[model samples]
Target: MSETYLIDRATVLTMDGATGATPVERSIRVHDGEIVAVAGALDPQPDDVVLSGRDRLVVPGYVNAHTHSWEALFRARLDNLPLEHWMLLSYPVLGLAPLSPDLIRLRSQLVAIESLRNGVTTLVDDVLEIPGQTEDQLAAVFEAYRDSGIRANISGHVMDRPFADHFPFLADALDADLRRQLDAVTVVRGDEYLDYARGSAQRYADYAGGRLRFMLGPSAPQRCSPDLLAGIDEIAATYDLEFHIHVLETRTQAVTGAEFYGKTMVEYLDALGVLNERVTMAHGIWVTDSDVEVLADRRASVSHNPISNLKLGSGIAPWRKYLDAGVNLGIGTDGMSSSDTARMSEAVKAAALLHKVTGPDYRQWPTAQEVLTAGTLGGARSARLGDTVGSVEVGKRADLVFYDMNSLAFTPRNKPELHLVYSENGSSIDTVMVDGRIVVRDGRVTSVDERAVLDELQARGPELRRWQDELETLNRALLPAFDRQYASVMARQVAVDRYSGRGECWLN
Candidate 1:
């Protein structure tokens, strides 16, 4: 039995769907990792721990709907590059050695630490092992999440096609040697990955008492074969798991869809009967209005990654279209190297403000409350964990973030949601509790030795960089080929223009 907690007289934003538009003064009771009661007042029992919430604002903990946590070790290492070119170096098809199991555990812990510090209690990690997936490495990630006490939905990113398939003109643009190099790279069979997922699901089905869930992650539509995509969907159905995948993120991807399938990637998925409620598409940019309609009609969700999309020059997603079409929306930080942090506050702010540039209609701009809801409840729904987490109502998991209203971010606060979306950036977070466990108090993690973890990473920085450089060198050798491919794709006209400078052809 866990210790009962009584948070008394705090401003609570329940986010329970039935709550009012604004927060109200309420006390919450928690025991056995669940919220037992919420009301105007709660009397503490003799064995209960009473916490005064006089100057605190309690809200549902943020959720990072999409992220590549394994890239934490090399965060912000590559910048000013588009998704296509950037991933070549970060996710090289060849010559990159697999990270040691110990290092994988350490990196996963780092992601959890940063996420907790940022008030993100739940996150969906699309783990891409690059060269291949292994049981030992997967176990290391699971161990880190279990020990760190943060709820996480993890998946092995699966793609059964050669990396070169992403570029339609690869054969013409690349030299024979480079083409052969790509061909020589081994890709696991679709059935093999399915088997692995099944084995892992059975092994960790009830892991950490629902604190951890194994999900299906297809790398992306263009990077995967049709059969593999279907197979993944089938596996998801068999296991009753939510599946996450990347959709049209960039102009190049939109072009790939037209050239490969003679339709949009969203339509391709729909044709395959896989774009349903169980699917969560990351970075649904470079999509058409019809694509948005399909997503909404199918009851699928979109994990909007504004920060990463901007960083990668992937262009802004159809924020208004998604919302207006009734598409369930979620926000994410993307990856450590892309957004450089696991902070949900930053993502929430971006989601709240970035859509204003779409047009002069201020009415269409996202409100602070809307973005905050997307960052929490919308994310939980996208991950298929809506009924369990993402709210402060009774029967929901006790994932709560208490913000110090006395902090500078909340000084003279008029609207708590506005302050949170416009001013707070995780610094105002005083305590973060997940699953009725105090994982963070006074801005420090209680689960693991954070300082020791940082020290080990600092000591190993040089070695990791050296190993990364070796892989970069191999990938960089094909830069000229990729450069040509990128130019050729950009030169071709796509149906939709998602870039900010729509009229101008920047390639010239």
Candidate 2:
């Protein structure tokens, strides 16, 4: 493997190290999968692969901070459903997915290709354990990430409670026979789950030359027992791993937490000593100002999924307040079933615009630059890669996106930041690189058989559709009772309400 170098005189946006916010005309040099220098000019070797920067703007690759890429194949299977219904009723098909290792690899590859083509270099897959999680299943997940050539933090989710028990009053709402049927939930022992977490962290931590990091996923407070959360926290502390857990993504979770623990789920986790610097709370929509402070004080981060939030009718997260409170904010496409796309630019645009509905203060709205930072550096913090790949700078890994200025969206080119977050979709991206490797160029995936993967999925789409139909039929019988219970909870008030129009406003 000889050295490779690239020199370009294009405008460069180095979203790096607390400075270099503006895009400047500069030249860049790369050697051995890392950036060696970024300056006005570079003398390249005769054999180096030199790329012209005449029509390109080189920027740091984005960190798609949170996702469940395994479910990428099941996009749009369940849509327009609330989080509770989606999780308990429709999305249960994920746990019992009848996929072989080969299918998993192809699905993950497709997800990687989509993300890479859209200028995302790192994906933090907060992956769930498929039912009867064998070593083979676990290894398949990591191997797919490795072979895909994208940086990832593959957190293995651990949950002890059944789907029926994730919310309070759920079991009570069902008949005895129905409740008994739901009680036969798969339970992986605490010790066993912890062992898997540890093994995965060790096995994949240094794999692919440290392009992968492993984290612990305790699921949510209601999804996992207290003991399990504690055990996970201990392992995370011992191994210095991050905790990627979903919290308060929906109003029902907020209501259920107050009823169960007499506190918010964030408050409960804080009491359990599980909230810390390494914890990245996903979809932190239903949090209060004090909750924001708590997270900020702990040095914790939040992965905001605006598209999924809007799709599920989850309320807008307090992004302005979170930023004001010094909380690191990250952007995500969530899972394919939730947002139905792995394109980070969609989430970036949504994050920039979704907060304007809450009040009349324009200053409180998230700016394109702020949201861009969230999509880049802040997202890297969520993945525990704050120092590595989120920025374009000397001594960092050469993970980059080259946006073509020739795109129609940027033809007039007023402000790059505004165009990036407001007007541009990913079509402006002409090239994408991860770990100094060109995975996407000319707006196409290069590292994998993209068409073959899509063709296989197209041919095999019915198997998943049939599973979805079966689950829909099974869940239709239970939605009436669940809806009633959910409505009852929504009518009542807690310490606070995060959902809009559900109750009285707390602000005067």
* Sequence-dependent TM-score of model 2: 0.95
Q: Tell me the number of clashing residue pairs for each predicted model.
A: 0, 0
Using TM-score as the measure, which candidate wins? 1
Off by over 4 Å in 2: 18-20, 93-98, 501-508
**TM accuracy, model 1:** 0.97
Give the number of the best model, judged by lDDT: 1
TM-score of each: 0.97, 0.95
Q: What's every prediction's RMSD, in angstroms?
A: 1.8, 2.2
Query: CA shift at 65, candidate 1, in angstroms?
Result: 0.4
Query: In model 2, what are the clashing residue pairs, if there are any?
Result: none
Q: Which regions of candidate 1 fall more than 4 Å away from where they truly are?
A: 501-508
Local accuracy of candidate 1 as per-residue lDDT tens digits, 20-40: 337789999999989999999
lDDT of 2: 0.81
